[model samples]
Target: MKAAVVGLGVEGIKATKALLDYGWKVYATDLQTEIDLEELKISISDAKISTYDEKINISTNNLTIDLGYLDECEIDSSDAIVISPSLCNTKIAKKALSSGKLLSDILDKHKEIFTIGITGTNGKTTTSLILKEILENAGKKILIGGNAGGGFEGYYDLILKAEKGNYDIIIIEVCDMTLEFCDYAFNFDLVGLTNIGNDHIDVHGSIENYKNSLLNFSKNKTTFIDKNQIYLKEFKESNQINELVEYDESNYDLKLFGKFNRLNAGLATAIAKVLDVEDFIIKNTLGNFEPVEGRLKEFKLNDSKIYIGKTDNSDAVKSILNEKYFYATFIGTPRSNEEHRFEILDTVASHNPEIIVLFPGLEDTVEFGLYRLKSIGYEGRIEIANNLDEIISLLAEYSHEDAIFIGGNGQKNIIEIQDRLELLTKNCN
Candidate 1:
């Protein structure tokens, strides 16, 4: 067997190691220059695979590497192509798909393993994490993977673990981009659709296309969807889903805020029920589960409360605003379309926070977001922070006696700010 691995990022590196373990001839290519590849090789050589006793020594006998343009790689000569999630939409990926050589084809090899796939425009990470917690609480050995955030191992890593028979269940957070290419290759035991919203429009080309990609992926699988997602009903009538389980917010006592989170918990609970997790375990796990790091993670300093996470869409913004009173709100430059950014700005403006802080993001996006906020009749105080230090200073000054919401496209930036604020508070004490 032979495989061509694309983009030697985290996923690609894992895929290469796994292929080598399977005794396959692997040809890996990345756009990074030879110098970068050498650096990556050095890192890989130094790193130890926690799953195994040996270090990741890439055997050179059947391994080939190429650097520079992806077009120059001899991908056509390989029997299969394993592409990094970042480059799933590239021309090379399309060529691989047309030739039926996606790395996802290996999914069929793990039919004995029970796989649960969770996907949505939002809340998928929460749902996947929630399910993982519940299952673990019930003493189920499971491997959680995919885009579950917080630097969790991805699908390829899960594959290697699954092959080792170390887990009984696999929970994969299937993002839209992965679904675009994986398609029906994911033969999951059960799948959960948290809810579809207007997201990844740039990647999928349209909301309809994005929804279709998810729907198609769920075809012939026992899928669980939110009962309130009425839009799915029309598609369900046409799609040949094995069994569609409609779940509603059972209103489990949850620490996580917002109705959206309740819906996420509901979907996770419903899936847990199917897996025979006890009701007490599910309830207990959810009640103690804190918000995912980049999903409305709460922080308290002195008397003020701060909530930080990704709030890129109007609905997500509205959900947070409706759940609690925020005296101030911080928004980063929107990464979506101009119309969507305006919608988010308009939604935030309508809430009328005491102050709206526009932190740094893409230079072009920051300028347009300011224009949109002002155009939306936002007369409240608008502060612009040039960097994280400025943002920390602003937070220290304003977040003394009230609640504030920090949301934007820059999740990493938000996390960094949170870390800095925590460190500052710790030093003060």
Candidate 2:
């Protein structure tokens, strides 16, 4: 009657507590011996879950749960082993499955909690938030969780909360990385793939493998996929999934930028429809849906407007570009994704924006991205800003006639940029 929680990372911490609540003699597995087990045991759960790491000499009486991952460890003897999505590839994961199934494989244990899972390279956060509102408007007791899906807590913590609260439904933001750790287990009532974009090459080996992993994640589940997504047909042809619904984008009055976001909304709407959300409620949600900050978040000034999308990848930048307005775009980067940076700069080059303001980023790739823009034969003015404040000043001055855009991978610094734009709008008023 004992269970072990593997990998004491974000997901591991929550899983330990959840096992304890499930009335199993619980033990938390950690790699660090110096971690304080007493501080982690709060009074709310009303259970004693001990900690263990065999590598370091740490004293603990709860040998059944703690110190389970060490050599000569008896983790495989446990009745059930719940794992974090991040641990799918580690040596510890290999050991956990040496005798048992994955954490995701046993999700059916919670039969009362219907689940909806969403996956994509972009728009995961935005779509999840919108779905939350739509379900809330329908008066359903909804809960949300996943890797950065919305909650600051880990996926395991959120799952524990949903179970403890007895929610009617749970919406999870699934990722190839997260699902890969668990053999892509779990068949939900509803699933979604927003769009397969150009990223995550290193993890999945290639785009083809990445798509395959996503298809595997949706195996035997009714998936609502974007009609315009480049990989939909490829994904459909590869898998024998018969219940695929192609969500065609409607001309909804969405508040987010680009036709792609409208398409993202379309995917969410299809799921909401299946959930029996009324049409009027869906329309109301979209009309009032504010974009997630730094993901096509809008800013305004007197007679001028700017949209900020946080990334230098072509998929992110190209979505915000409008052909009608003379574009004054601020772009630069850390070359973190060097291949994608070149592709984004190439896309920006073709648009022939009115003015290109190079915002300073703290990466060596920043210089190389700018060089790529110059080598692309951009004939317009490309001004360099030593600081973000300079870029804001430049954007304010040129926004009178041209539609301004700020694109980069520097999301951490965007708050200052947004603050500056808001200040300008206030001053204009």
Candidate 3:
């Protein structure tokens, strides 16, 4: 079976590896130069992908990613096309759908199966992973993937393995990117809409476009709404939805912590009920399942100081509402016309915490927040750590005084930093 995997982003890289593992003649091409090819080649080789095409003898052992202008690549003859991270582009989505190619829009193919789709701005990843753990613990063979964020790279192989008539429930985190190319022909047994927030405006251009894309994803499925507390509710009509089920804490004992997680648990439980997972198993899994690393993940220091990685979205910082002393961090600022930087800064200031450390890596991103902070005449000790080690060391040294280190800005190595902090603290104690 000949297959073509599009784009070379993280998702595309993973999908290409999956296609090869499925015993397919894989044609993986990206629009990158020779220099950009090294990292991707290394990743594919590390994954040990094997291509079946005699013409394209690319094996994981011989990791050489071939590059071509998109116009030149031979995609027409491939038996199936997998549109992944790259499908975010409307032009590519339009081209693939119009081509009449048998396209697996996402890595986890949900054709003729009990599939659950989750979408929203922020909590999708946490909710998707939580739901997957709940279903799996219930002894339901589950295949979970789709831009839900928890490194579900090789889900296609899992689906293929399950095709031997094994798994019952399949959970997929369907992002706007995945939904853009998704043939709405497929419907989910449960559709989870966590919450609508302003995000990815650079790609969609407007709030209306972003909200519509999400609403379109939940259309006609067993839609799960945590709450109707979304600004975009004005754009949607209540009567438009067919079988909308609103889930809240009164329904199930969801184990995940935080108000945001509580909301996610509500959605997960609703889907579990649809799949008929036992209440006992659902409760057990929720209690056992820990938050994924680097996402509000906690780390302790020898001095008894605590650091929490709150990096994904600004709204994620809201999870730390009750905590008194929070040293919040942030990353890439929103595009010029896209996002508002003051909203987060204003919220952080409103708390009137002991200290605010702003370490925005991309100088420009930090400037917006810094400017906003200065405008308020806030005289808290605001310091910037240039590198990851500096940030960790700073947190270790100065943050010993009963303060919560909220690591976010330019902390891409958040998981590693959190792990090291925990390990160091353990040894010191």
Candidate 4:
């Protein structure tokens, strides 16, 4: 069988490899041919897979539109087109649905198979990882990948490969953008929609749009919902799904402290229950599951505390609970809702935090947070560091007793920060 993997993102590249591994002739395309396929560990010498520029204009014989808004080729004869996470493009989804091709949107495919699709603005990664741990502990042969769900590349092929093994359950982390790409929904045995927050408007456009996208993603599945303020009682009335479980926030018996995480743990527990996983196993796994990297990861300096989380949008900072005697750092860009950023600043200021460090990211997105902080009557101490290392150094110098938070999309930089922290920890020892 021949498969076309679209978009050169991590998901696309992984999908291409899975196709090639399964002995399928794979054609990969990306608008930017310079995309670092090597980072995804794709070997150029592999004969089964070929990467080409989006403008290459292939023959109409066997083509698939992998890149959104760049679908100039024809996919009339391809056996199937596997659209992975990039399914965010409405046009690509429409084309796939209309073309009648053997379409497998990872989100949709997850729904079709005995899969668990987890989606939300945040906490999906941690929730998916926790659920994976729970299922694996139960001795169920499982395949986990997609979004924060890493490892296997192509979803369908992974499912096929698992047939040779003894795995029964598959867990996936689905992003909102890819929600529309689902064609032939594999309605998950269990689904989880983590807390909905004001995020990803650049893609989803509006909060309602984002919620609707999520609703679509969980089509006809036994879904578990985190009690989101925005989506509260959202699932209670939905007749589309008969097995929806409204997870209680208080049922989260995990070591993860944040309210958001409590919701995540609760949702995971609800899903685990659906799978007949024992309560003790669920509770133990929840307590054992530490926050995922770059999301509330705790790093202790000599006399300071630093917490890091992915902060592509400013709304992430709202998750930080107000506490006394701790200075908080607002890292990364701000979002469309300046109120959220200002609210965070006011919260920090009200706490009279020892310090407020801002890492306005390298893009326009940073403005929403930094400016909001300044406008919110916070004149005490605000310093913008060049990078994570400088920020860490500065934190070490100022108020040694205060807590530090490295927030935002800047988290991809944590690997370097971890290296530096290790060096510092070693030097002290």
Of the candidates shown, which would achieve the greatest TM-score relative to the real structure?
1
Candidate 3 — what's its lDDT? Answer: 0.60
Q: What does the lDDT come to for candidate 2?
A: 0.68
Q: Which stretches of candidate 3 lie over 4 Å from their true place?
A: 32-68, 71-73, 85-92, 105-109, 148-150, 154-165, 183-186, 231-240, 250-256, 302-307, 322-343, 360-378, 409-411
Could you estimate the TM-score for every candidate? 0.82, 0.77, 0.80, 0.79
* Alpha-carbon shift of residue 173 in model 3 (angstroms): 1.3
Writing each residue's lDDT as its tens digit, candidate 3 over 109-189 gives: 456678777777767777888888887787777776765134555334434544445567667766655675443534477
lDDT of each: 0.75, 0.68, 0.60, 0.61
* Regions of candidate 2 where Cα sits further than 4 Å from its true position: 1-86, 99-112, 149-152, 182-186, 235-239, 322-326, 332-338, 360-364
Residue 261's lDDT within candidate 3 is: 74
- Segments in model 1 whose C-alpha atoms lie over 4 Å from true places: 1-3, 7-26, 30-68, 71-73, 76-80, 85-102, 106-108, 148-150, 335-343, 362-364, 424-429
RMSD over all Cα atoms, model 3 = 5.3
Candidate 2: worst 10 consecutive residues by lDDT? 56-65
For every candidate in turn, the CA RMSD to the true structure comes to: 6.1, 5.7, 5.3, 4.9
Instruction: Kindly list the per-residue Cα lDDT of model 1 for residues 99-211, writing each as its tens digit.
Output: 87776664445556788988877788888999999999999997887852334656775665676676778888887678854444455878899877765566678778777
Rank candidates by lDDT, best first: 1, 2, 4, 3
- Of the two candidates 2 and 4, the one with more favorable lDDT, higher being better, is 2
Quote the lDDT for 337 in model 3.
Answer: 45
Candidate number achieving the greatest lDDT relative to the actual structure: 1
Total clashing residue pairs per candidate?
0, 2, 2, 13
